[model samples]
Target: MSIWWSLHLRREAASVPLARRLLLGTMESAGVDPDISYDLSVALSEACANAVEHGGDGALDGAAEAYRVTAYLDGETCRIEVADSGPGFGAAGGDAGRLSAEAENGRGLYLIQELADHVHFGTEPGLGGAVVSFDKILKWRKGASPLLAV
Candidate 1:
């Protein structure tokens, strides 16, 4: 079975946990394993935090204060994408894998890469924003089939 959802949220710190909770609820209800669910929730938080912090035009007003998040669950795999209207990673030119440990910031992408089974960066659909997408292969806790919930 396949399930998906998308959320267009304000670029606020509070919105981060809202997205995480929703993802956790969805996965738990579908019988996803606890460990996989925890990892994905943490990874999703990092991705959402990145979008909230960097995905907007440097302006503090208007439409620049929003980001989009999408998630898909298909059988044993779950994919997630977070996109923002700010300048993309390409413009910043920092490698996600090479961040310094002592830096006060810049670890979101690295965390996502570490948690997700696959990761990709690109432009948001039709918005020219930075998009960080990742996916993980899920393991059911007791041979449960998520398709049944579909």
Candidate 2:
């Protein structure tokens, strides 16, 4: 079985923290622990920030076109989808490598890849938008992949 929650908000700096908090709350309610909760929060925040940054100009005209987030929970697997009403970008593959020690930026996808068990993009052609999704496995039981055997 799966459960989902969604919300849309202005694509602004202030909305980033709000999005993080709301996602954290939902995950916590689903029994995600504190440490894991922090990971989820950070990953979700970075994804949303990326969306807004690349979410194209005039995407948020005083809360007009907004960014949407959808989270789906199924047992130990929780998938978070952050969608933006703007043009999409090409995949970086799982090649979301970490930034160099001296680099000041470019670690968003890298962090998300490290924290989430799976990360993928859902691009809707013609519609001209995309959904960035990452999945986490909480309290994994036997037979689960060791990478997500938290």
Candidate 3:
């Protein structure tokens, strides 16, 4: 069974938990293992927080200001993508894993990389925004089929 969902949310701090809760609920409903679900939820929170903080301009000047979060589950693997309309990280994003421990910021991408099985940084599909995408190999609870037959 394969499932996918997407959210377009305002670039506000409150929107971060909303995305996380939705992801958590979806994973739970699909019978994903508790550990895997927790890890993915935390990783999703970091990704969403990044999008909220740096994804786009928060001005209310009639511009379509928002960020996007997308998740896909197929069999034993799940992939997630978070995107924003800001100027993007440019060259800095390439060094995401090299942040120092004492740094007050710049740890979001590193956390995502640590939690997800695979991570990618790029532009949003069709929207030309900064995108951080990752995937994990899921382990479902007992009695859960790897693929849900639609």
lDDT of each: 0.84, 0.70, 0.81
Candidate 2: clashing residue pairs, number: 0
lDDT of 2: 0.70
- Rank candidates, lDDT, best first: 1, 3, 2
Model 3, 1-150: lDDT tens per residue? Answer: 689999999888999999999988899888898899899999999988887777775556523378889999887788998888876656556446465545577687778888899988876555556888899998877887544434
What ranking emerges by TM-score with the best candidate at the front? 1, 3, 2
The root-mean-square deviation over C-alpha atoms between each candidate and the true structure, in angstroms, is 2.5, 5.7, 2.6
- The global Cα lDDT (0 to 1) of model 3 is 0.81
For model 2, how does the per-residue alpha-carbon lDDT over 1-150 read when each residue is reduced to its tens digit?
Answer: 456788787777888899889877766555666677788789999888977776654633543257788877776788888877666654442223444334466478667777888887655455556667998876532343423223
Candidate 1 local lDDT, 17-105, one digit each (tens): 99999999999888899899999999999989988888788775666799989999987799999988887766445465465545567
Candidate with top lDDT is 1
After superposition, candidate 3 runs with Cα above 4 Å error: 58-64, 91-97, 100-102, 125-127, 143-150
Q: What are the TM-scores, per candidate, against the unseen true structure? A: 0.86, 0.74, 0.85
lDDT of candidate model 1 versus the reference: 0.84
